[model samples]
Target: MTKLFCILDGHSTPFSVVVSPDDTVDDLKKAIKKEKEPEFDYIPADKLNLWHVSIVIGDDEDEKTITLSEHPDAKKLHATSEISEVFGSAPAKKTIHVIVQRPSQGSSAGTSSQVNSK
Candidate 1:
């Protein structure tokens, strides 16, 4: 098994998981859902949509776009020249990054202070 660094939606918080070289991109998506979703037990892996997410391998700036419907083959799903040509170079290992934003409360003061100061 190989350890891969995953960045959830460009989020500063990253997760590390050990996966087989044969693991497909879809497999990774499942792992993400399991970790992030509050109701993962009710949700199915295939039901989740990740077509818009960008996948970055290692330190490479190039982002690979793949969906569950496409790139079923993990081995074939590597960062090919075709993808590299369009996106950029591929990293030696795979790395995924995710970004998320927290909802902001009204007022310039922090939530704790705003509620307490009032």
Candidate 2:
């Protein structure tokens, strides 16, 4: 098994998951959905907008944005490329901050701040 790190929504924070080298990009998507939203039955990978997410592998200095369909096969290669892109160029490791908004009670307000940090 190999570990892959991804930046969800371009936040400084990143999410990590372990995947079999044989697993496809599809598998990674499933794992991500399970980790981030276990309650949801399914999460369409394409809906994520491949360009919006960045991947980092190891010590590489190029960030590659790939579609979930392009992941699988040679998982390690993808992991390496992605990690290098996101973390390789920074002087210090960065953190990603996720912000969520909820509806406010009363006052006919419909806004709230509900963040989920991973």
Candidate 3:
């Protein structure tokens, strides 16, 4: 297991979350909820916009949008371009920065009803 340092919404400071390379985005969300649910007592964990959240690494210009089941090795590759910057390259555990993002205009817009009755 690697301890990933992350910054989440409603958090005042960075925190470490231990996870395995096999874990998925949903797994990470659950870990985040475990730490944040208490502070955001009124909001249900399911309503936290987990689907719209993004896990980022490094700077925005080089940032990548990771999939729900992307492994740590794959995410690390997406985060950095150097061949030496692979996961577990050093003594420190890998970390990922988290950010809340709005879904693309066309992503979920099709879910709405468009009545054509004239």
- Each model's TM-score, in the order given? 0.36, 0.39, 0.40
Compared with the true structure, the alpha-carbon lDDT of candidate 2 equals 0.40
lDDT digits (tens) for residues 13-35 of candidate 1: 45565545555555655665567
Per-residue lDDT tens digits of candidate 2, residues 1-118? 5465554532434566666656655555556656666422333432222222233344443354334444333222232234334324331333221111111243333223457889
Q: Where does the lowest 10-residue lDDT sum fall in candidate 3?
A: 76-85
Candidate number with greatest lDDT? 3
The clash number for model 1 is: 12
Candidate 1 scores a C-alpha RMSD against the true structure in Å of 12.2
Off by over 4 Å in 2: 38-42, 50-118
> What is the lDDT, from 0 to 100, of the residue 65 in candidate 2?
34
Error of 3 at 66 (Å): 20
Error of 3 at 64 (Å): 23
Say which prediction, candidate 1 or candidate 3, comes out ahead on lDDT.
3
**lDDT (10s digit) by residue, model 3, range 34-99:** 766565443333343332222444444233434434433323212212212233433243334443
